[model samples]
Structures are given as C-alpha cells and as structure tokens.
Target chain A: MSEPTPHSMSETTSTTDDDETQRSTAADPADPAASADPTPVPGETGGKFGRYGGQYVPEALMPAIEELTDAYQRYVLENEDGFMDEFRRRLREFGGRPTPLQHAERLSERYDRDVYLKREDLLHGGAHKLNNALGQVLLAKYMGKDRVIAETGAGQHGTATAMAAAHLDMPCEVYMGERDINRQRPNVFRMTLNGATVTPVTAGRGTLKEAISETMRDWAGSVEDTHYVIGSVVGPHPFPAMVRDFQSVVSEEARRQAIETIGELPTDVVACAGGGSNTMGSFAAFLDDETVSLHAVEAGGADLSIDEEAGVAPNSASLYAGEEGVLHGARTKLLQDAHGQIVESHSVSAGLDYAGVGPELAHLVDEGRVIPVAVDDDHALEAFHLLSRTEGIIPALESAHAIAYLEAGTDTEAGTDSEAAGDDGGEPDAAADDSLGETVVVTVSGRGDKDLESVIEETAARDIDGAPDMSAFTEGI
Target chain B: MSNRAVSDRSGNSEAIAQAFADGPAYIPYLAVGDPDYESSLEYVEALERGGADLIELGLPFSEPIAEGPTIQGAVVRALEGGMTPDRFFEFVEDLDVDVPLVCMTYYNLIYQWGETEGPRPFVERAAEAGLEGFVVPDLPAEEADPLREACDEFGLDLVFIVAPTTEGDRLDRIMDRVSGYVYVQARLGTTGAQDDVSDQTAASLDRLREYDVPKAVGFGISAGDHAERIVAGGADGIIVGSALVDIVAEGVESNRSTAAVADRLEAISRELVAGAERGSRARSTGDPS
Candidate 1:
C-alpha cells in the first residue's frame, strides 16, 4: 500500500452539492472571533461557559440532557414558589444554610493579614457539597426522577448526595474510584450508612476521572428515571451552570457576611479548584467586582514547577499547565499529554485529583478574572496542620490548598518556593506579604475528617523537621 | 490491487448513496483490533462477505463514555492488545474490504493529532487510510465546526447524530451540514442489546425523514428482529454495534479461534442482512405498519 496525497484524495472524492452547501453552512475561517474565544460564557442559556461547556454526550442521552436542561430552566431557575422555595427550605433545614464566615484571628495574626474562613466545613455532611446535593435532589424530585446517581472523588459529594437522597426517600447510587474509596473510607462509610450503594470504579487510574466516566455511563444507561447529581461544576452543559448556580449561595452569603463583619468587601477571595465547584461558587458573586481579586488554588500534587528529572510538572493545575481538551462531556483545560490522552493527576487530597478543571473556571482563567495558583503537597499538608493548630480546624486537604495559597504569599505563584516556612511561627517572607492584601476570605470547602488517614500517611512520609507533630491528632482513631 | 479497487469504490458519497439506494442497508460495527489485530482483520472480511453494506470501525479510546458494557469490554480488550492510533490506521490501510468504512472515534484523538494552528491532521490521515467519514459520538454540532471544516477540506463525510430529544433548531443545526447518513439512536441510552425497539425509535425516524439525508438507526439494536423492525420504521439503514461487539467478546472469552470468531460474526451479520432485506421488502409492499 502507498500513501495517498490529500490533494489527490479530495480531487477524486464525490462532490454531492458541495459548493452550495459549503457556501451556505461552512463556518467562516476568516472570522477571528469565531475561533478566538474558545471558552463559553458562564450561565449562558445552553449551559455554556463561554464556549467551553456544551452537550457533547452520546445521542442516546440527548433527551435526558434536554429534559434536565428544560426542568432546570423551568422549575429551578424560573420557578419562584415551587422549586427554589423547596430547595432553599431543604438547604436551610437540612443542609444548615448560611454557614458562618468566621474570623481566622489566630491564623490571621500568623500571616499578618485579616483572614476569614467561609465555613462550608461547618455545614451538614461536613462540606459545601450538601448545598449542591440538596438543590440537585430537589430538581430531581421536580423532574419526577426517583433514582439519583452521582460520582465522587473525596466521597464528600457522595456522602452529601446520599444524605439528600435519603432525606428525600430516593434510592441513590454513588460511583467512586477504588483508590478514593480506600483513601476516603470515612466518607464512603457515611455514604453507605445513608443507604447509597457505593460502586467502586477501578478504571483509568481509579480516580475522579474514572468515577465520572462510570457515572456518565450509568446515567446513559438509565436516563429515564435517574438523575445524575454531578458533584462539581463540570460535565456537559447545564451541569456546570446548574452546579455553579446551586453552589453560588456560598459566595452570596460570603459577600453579605463580608459587608456585615468586615465593614467592606473582601480584598481577595480564595478557594481550591477541584472540578472548581467551590471556586466558582465563591467567585461568582465577586466576578464583576474588579476590586475583589479571585484566587483559585489547584492541587500541585508532587510539584508543579518544572523538574529537570521528570521533564514535566506532575500536577492537577489544568489552568496553569494544561491545554484545551474535552473530558467528561465538556471542553475545558485538561491535564493531557501530547497525544491528548488524560494524564493521571496526583494529589494528597482525592478531591483535587482531577485531570480537568471546570469550564467556568477555565473561562475565568482565560479572562484573567481568576488567578490560578497550584499548591504543592508539602505546602498543602503544612496548611492542613497549621489550620488545625492555629485555628483549631482540621481542613480537608482539598481546602488546605487554598490556605497554602495564602501561606505561600498571595503575590507569588504557588509551588514556586521549595522551602516550607508557614509553621515556624515567623511571618511569611515579606515578599509574600505584599502580594496578598489584607482581608482575604478562603473557602474552607470541607472538614478533614474524611482525609485523616491519607493526611497521616502523607505527613509521616514528609517527615519535615519543623512540621507540627500529627501524632496526637491521629492517636485515638 | 483488488483492495485498491475496493478502496477506490468506497470512501465517497456515491458509494454510501448507492448502498442505501437499493434498499435498507445493514451496517455492522466492530471495534478494530479487539481481542487481537489479525482476528479483527478476519472479522472485517467476514462482515463484508456476510453482506454488510457499510462497516463502522470503532477506534477504541481509553474512555468510551457513550458505550455500554459490551462495547466497553471490547474497548478494554482492544487497548490491552495494544491498538494505538498508528496501529489502528495501519490495519485500516491494509484491510481489503468492499464496504464503505466509517471510523467511530472520540474527538480527542483527532484533536490531539492536529496542531493548535492548522487544519486537523487526523482527517487527512483518515482519508489516506481509506476511511470514508467519522461518527464521533461525543462531538456535538455546537463544538463540531472545526472538525466539519477539516472533513470538508479532506473530502470526508461528517455524520451527525439525531437523537429523539433533538428537535426544533438543534435538529436543523445538526442536519444542516451532514454529509453522510444521520445516526438515529433507538432509545435514550447507551449502545447495548435490547429485546425490542422503543416506540420513540419510530417517532425519531419519522421526524428525521423530513431531512434530505439517509437515516441509520443504532443503539440497543441487538437482533435481526430489531433490524427488521427499525428498517420497517423507515430507517434507510440499520447500524448494529454492541450486539456484534458482544459476539466477538464471547468468542474471545470462550477461547475460540480467530476463524471461529469470524464465522460467528459472519453468521450474525448474514441474519441481520436477511432481516434488513425482509424489512425493505415489507416497506416496499406496504405490509409494515
């Protein structure tokens, strides 16, 4: 066999009303705007985050997507008395709505900045995931779907979904990666106790990506009476927008609290980006406020800076290190190889171990509305311990990444400095202080209870000389 | 030389139009390089001999979200057998089949091959490898303009899927630039074997008939009976995927020979072809309701 030239092939192929059709329908290649802005606008009618999110699913699931989109628009977004009221009631009654905006006095003094923690960690199910779960479960009820399916990474979302489903008396199935199931055993047990059948996904590095693929396949197979309660602001159109809308309450409350407590809007809002739910939620209300800087912390995993030996930064910082690609039904910044196959992301926190960031976050990164920072495992672990010691809060490793951002000094990019210095009780490098202004709010996405085992193992492995002894914390259980 | 002639006859609009012109065509799907490469080659040949009008060669990706368990298992086997894009194309280049071969793949594979600045290289490579078109399950029309332009430039057909839920302007947008037959899913689920076709299948096809393109119904189409019923419902062609993948998977599980797998696939393909013919005849004679 010989290679055929493209010119020869095009010449010989049949032309079936080509010129007429081409003229009528072909997209104009000359138009720069058509190709320039790849990210979809957030909250667009069709679940677009500029151009990043759209329904890129199988044909079989199109009806379900449409049905869900229709229901979301009709009963949730537009319905004042029916869907929204019930969702608010459930969030208030069950999910413990309006989680406090606590002044991190001790942590603030340590860093020489007024730091506040958006206490989603204090909410029901011990995370902000309950907010989305409550809202989506209410939407499922409105859509008359009796069964709910979800995919979880750290199991916080799964536990939250299970709680909501149990509260609604709906059967729930949660798909979790085998690795996550092992690491997040506490949350897995919580989900099981809530009556959700947790199916362990063993495919594709056994992480959030695989769990999502498995859950999507399940949704594809059972779209009629089942609703996929996507844990984050990811997946196909409607999901990213819908989840962001549900979690937007986080920022709305934070904004109001900032005004009431701080006497002014926050100078900077920080949140970790793992599929970017909390980040989008915390940043959504402050998007138009140019004065309020938005900082998104991605899990740096081992290291994000260029390492000579590895030849690449092994990190989940898609906005910083990844390129545009489609994953789990939406086009977003993905941690993909040269060949576009998704590379495995490593993070101490399973919640941040995702190859793709949410489309809305990707859009914000493009627009420069959100500054993307990647926090390394060591710094995140340091933040995890520092919060526990100073603030008496054991933050989820995912949330620790956000605190690591502040610890690293807001001005400098995360994972840039190799030295771990936050726990020395000395002020962070003066350079670090200049970048992060006073009055910063970090979204404490979840409590660290589900991540205690992984944290213990990681902390033990690090064995830093000045690290806080975690022995007392892990002594009992 | 015979293979060259077959390649020349395929990969064009005329061939696909001709296949559907006679009657309702039977298009059988096989995950390329499943079980092993050589076995997959034999399976393709058997499908052609078994009267397949068109063949959908599935290039298995690491994650096939649109697929059901049967196709997913086949993909796992294919990947385990080391079926990379280069090997998949090499196999296609060597295949001496007569039927028009449309590659079924995810968009990422194509996106990965092309540079960020230029026309997609995958479309050019696919044309050179003797593929007629693409059936990217994940590339919706909204995100499909770039690929569609590449396909237009490469002289390849870009098939679009019309689901039961696709209506109003979305359906129009999908059908607007479709070069090959439109893929009509039988139900609201992934590809798998089903006992009966849903009533929505008929309605979907009926809705699609207003468009000028030929319609091929797939997803959950398992048996010859399904083929018959779907074709009778006015589909210009029947695309059977998971059911055929299951046969190959069963053969591999049972440790059957490559020829045994080929033979089994051939038998099933023949049965489906017969059913398509019967359904075509029934439609022509006004015997189908």
Candidate 2:
C-alpha cells in the first residue's frame, strides 16, 4: 500500500483499499470517531491524533521501507505480551528510568516561584536522548536486525546508542559530521570507547544534515543488514512516530509524577526544542488539556530578533525563517530560503543547531496547538551561570535557553527597575547579576560538562577592569 | 498510424526471445537521426554486423521524459536535424536488418500521434518500422494495456518497467505482459552519472525475478564498472544509455570530425556492448561466482 517515491518518502500504507487518494494524517488517541475528522490538525493526521506518519522517498526504496513500517506496526499490535512492561523493567532496573524530578529550592525560594527540574541530565548519557536510543535498540533487537546505524550531533545520542548496541552485541556505526567530530571531540571519543565506528561524514555542510546524508548513504548500501536508528523524531515517516512513541514515556512519567505531587498536570509545561524531541515528548501527553499551556523555548543567540538594529539574532528560530518543505527526503517544514534551499540555522547550544523540527511539530504550530518562544544567547549564558551558582546544577547551554525565556517576559519592566535599582543585594555575585523575576519552569535539558570553556569566557567578559556600566545588562529579553 | 510508427509484426517478438534464449544476445541502439536517412540505414546494417541480438530503434520525439540533459539536447538537435515520423519510417523501411527492434519514444509524442484501433498510432507506426517492442518511459504499468493490445496485434512487445519502488502487487502487474525484459530505473534523482549502483536496484532485480521476467536496468549507467555491478546484482540486461549519448555528443562537440569521433564512439560502444553481452551470459547462468 505504501508508495515510496522521491515525493512520497514515507511508508504510506492506506487503511482502506482506496488509500491512494487520501493523504495520511496523524491519528487521534482519544477520539473514537477520529476517522470522521475533516482537517489534519498538527498532531493527528486528521484530528492531529496519530494516523499521519508515513515514509516519502524515491521510487527505489519503497519496498524496504514499507516492510519496515509494516513490521513495526505488526510488532506494536501483536507484542502485547508485557513488552512495554519488560521494557520498563529493563530501563528501570538496568538502564535507569524514572529520572528524579529535583526541587530547585534555591531558585524557588529566592524568586516567589515554584521551579522544579526534570533531571534528564541525570539519565545515563547526560541528556534525554538515551531514553529513545534505549527504546529503539530494543525495537531493532525485536525486529531481528543484527546491525544498527545512527547519526549524531554533540555525540550524546551516538554515545548512548553505542552503549546500547554494545550491550546488545549489535554491530553499530555512527555517522558524525566532520564539523561535529571536531566540535564534540569528547563525545566522539566516548562513542569510540563504546565500540562504535565513528564514521566522519564529509558531505554538504558537514553538520547534522551531512551526518544524516552519510547515514542514509550507508543505509542505501546496506539496507538488508542494517536498521537505521535515527536520533530524534525528525527523519522520514516512522522515525518521527517511533522516536516520539519511545520518548512519550518521559512525559508519561512526568504526568504521573506531577499529578501525584500537585493533584493535576502543571498549569504550564515548558521544554527546550532541539529537533523538539524533549519538548514535544514532555508536552504531547498533555496537549489537549486546555489548562496546561505548552511553551517551547529556543536558543536566541546575541539577539532574539535578527535585524541590524536588533544587534544579533536568536538561533532557535526554526519556523521564523523556515518554510514548509522537505529535508532528508521527508516533506515536513524546513528552514529554507525562498528558492527552497536549506539555510544555516544558529543556536548557542550545540544540541539546538538544527534547521528542521519534526513535521508533526510544524503541524502543531500551524494548528496553533503550541507556542514557540526564542531566548537570546547572552541571557542563556547568564541563566547557565545562575543555575550553576544558585542550584549547583551546571545546566547545559541548550537547557539555559529555556531558563532564558522564564526571564524574557520580565525584560522591559525589570530592565528599568534593575537599572534604577542595581544588584546591591546579599547574594552570590552570579545570582545577583541574573535576578530577573519570573515564575517559570525552565527545562534543565543536560549537564553543562560540555560547555565549561564557553561559560568561563562569558563570565570573564564581565570583569572588564571596572563595573563599567552594570545598567546595560538589565534587559530581560 | 503512419508507416514510421508501425513495426513489422512477422515473428519479431519470437526472434528477440529466440536470440536471448540462444547465444549472442543482440543489443542495438538507434539515435533518432544520424548523418542522413541513408546513414541511418547504414547504421542498422552496422548494428547487425556488430552482433546485436535485439535492436532498440530510437524514436525522435520533441520531449523525452527519462533522457538526461545531453540526450534531451541531442533529441532537440535531432529534430532540428530533420528527423520526422515520415522520414524515420522511410529510412527504417529501407533497412533490412533481420534482428528484432524496439521503438523507444516519449509518451506525449506517442499520444500526439493520435490513437488508431486500440493503441496509439505510434505503436501502429512502430509495427511499420519493423521493430519488435515499444518503450514508453512516462506510461505507468497500470495504463499500459492499450499499447500492449496494439503491440500484440502488430507482434511487438509492450515493455513495462519495475522501478526500485515497485511493490509486489505493482511488480505483478508490470511482469504480467512484460516482453523483451522488465526495464529497471537504475537510480533515484534525475539520471546522470552513478558512481555506485544503489542496493535498491539489487532488491528490485531480486524481487522481479520472482515473476520469472528478465530484468534490464537503465538510466545513468555511465561506466564499464557500473555494468559489472548491474550484472553482479542479478540484472539480466544492462542497458547503457547516457554513456552512449555522451559519446555521440562528444562527436558533435568536436566539430564534424567524423572519423576521430567515430573511432572513439565505436571503441567505447563495442567495449560496452561486449561487456553487456558478457553480463547477460553471467546473469542467465545464475553464477556470477
């Protein structure tokens, strides 16, 4: 039923015999009469539920992709013999699941706000990427694939997948962009140590996109022997669905924990959107809960808006400059130019330096299901230093962007007040400098072990011989 | 149907099958126009001497869907070079090459030729041209029956494709009446130079074998090395299209210095043809080992 063509990349299996006419949409989880829905909202194919996942590729690889998609679907339906229970057991006992939700007592009491941390950083690979990698590796094993191939940025997903593949004794190959190989040297070493062949990809841009290109090339060459374990929920058809299904446990657990602690889901759900895995995973389970507002904070480098007069632009703006097109063969929304060429995306965090988000997320933005917020680089650095000093959590710069938005709304009023009333208070110098008030849940995405130098340099920039003009740095935006 | 479009039915399909079944499979190519009509007649004789098992008579259409920029450009020039349906058939009717020939053209041109009886006039004219089959790149397997019926009446095979993406159901439809061989699209993206044959081609060939049809992969098969890969991957025939077009284009590029360019073209084409013949033997035997 699936027509895998260049234009139709995903494994689009029609539910009905007359399937060729209807475009696949995401399925709705709660609606029983979902098929009767007319429009494809962001999440469900029609109701923005779940039916929309498909593979669109060149005419060559349709059969293979269809086989895989059909296999995964069959596995999902038939493997009700406590597969998830067993998976949960393995993750909880061996790989470590239910990562603690830490109370940021310091930040909470200091500002009159309740700020808690979902410590995905404490998870095995120092980021939330491990959760999905573990799940995918399990899925591949169940499917009888002997080899695993993946592309990685910042080496977090690559290292985690390497660890899983090694534990499973599955031969693993990780494609890293030549640029990323240089930028994330430690992760590359970790992957090597974990018994993964780190293939340096020298293709277009030599970043995540190039790494993906190399991975696809590897796949096209060895489709029979390999299972392409994509890092995020952003590739072709089933990857976005599969990875999201795996990462859903994050929010599932969070929802349970939140309800047990506070009697209901949080009034506001916030996470950083790097390919939107953690953000979407954390917000997905509670999307239709009208009271629960979802906020995805993106990295805004020197400036949130990119204009000469605005000084510098924020890096986390995928849709702002992005157009709805295709990248890596899937027709989703992409950050492209008017001529449909992909544009280079910027973000202060290495994890966030991607040009495209998951297509479902684009649909969410289209249907107005989610609100995207961008935070500047300087503010993210300030947040990183503040979280580290005040809460003893060296939050990743990627995570710091979420923290930046928590204070972004206070930019103008707090800017004037702080200019008039300087940080002459009795607190650590770092926390005092970052004392913009807001009751916000900033996702501390990962530990900042990778960002020590950048943090040091930014902090060093503050001690310019004199206090110079402390008033200049008081704006919240 | 004009005289040019209709091919000679008289045992031509049986002859093509007989050639493949026996020894020395003939692989002849026809550019829309070469030198003059007299030269095209000479070219057919030249192909027969060169040991062509089956002749593929090129139909010069204005727009060829699967042709690369080079072939497309040449086709444009070939048209401007005074190749027409009437002129094309008049030349073909004169040539007495005993081998079976397949007429190849774009669907739009065939559609424009108008319909006669069941199939398009082009297929009818293909029978008049003394060809054995018709290769329409734009026509899908589902819609090939009209041409198939016409080709059957005229004793021409309506060759169908099984692209890399063709699933089992689609493959079944494609191989149901496929004659000559199931033409395989070699790669994704617009066809040009393919350094390495994609694994999808192998999968497509392997799957097509289930239907017991001979598989022939074409489009962007540029090198001698590519022929080896195609053969190794279980392809029954490797149709090298772009590389041949490049040779002819090179001849045009170097002015009308026919002897020099002809030497290069003949040498390359001979080497390629010989390799393809060897490949067909290897694949037929099912022992690349």
Please tell me which predicted candidate would have the highest lDDT against the true structure: 1
How close is chain A of candidate 1 to the true chain A, as a TM-score?
0.84
DockQ of 1: 0.36
Instruction: Give each candidate's interface RMSD in Å.
Output: 3.0, 11.6
Residue B220, candidate 1: Cα error in Å is 2.9
- lDDT tens digits by residue: candidate 2, B1-289: 2222234322237656675665334354556575445545655565566555666767665324344455655565565566766666666677787877677764434544533322457667767766667776645454456677677666677776566667766566566657766678766543455667787787777677666545677766766566666776676666655565566676667664555544554565566566666665676777563
Model 1: lDDT of residue A247: 90
For candidate 2, the docking band is incorrect
TM-score of every candidate:
0.85, 0.62
Among incorrect, acceptable, medium and high, the docking class of model 1 is acceptable
User: Model 1: clashing residue pairs?
Assistant: A39-A50, A39-A51, A40-A49, A40-A50, A40-A51, A40-A52, A41-A49, A41-A50
What lDDT tens digits, residue by residue, belong to model 1 across residues A1-477? Answer: 022211222333333222221222333233222222223442222556555767778765777888888887788768744888888887889888879999999878776678999999999989999989999988998789989999999998999999999999999999999988888888888999999999999876788988999899898768889999999989887888788888988988887788778877777888998899999889776654445667888888886643322223467888777788888888789877665666677788889888888887887677656777778888899888888877889999999999988866643434343222221111222223334667889999999988877887778778754566768767765
lDDT of 2 by residue, A280-316 (tens): 6776655544344556676555543444222122454
Report, to 2 decimal places, the DockQ of model 2.
0.08
Off by over 4 Å in 1: A1-45, A305-314, A410-434, A465-477, B1-12, B117-119, B285-289
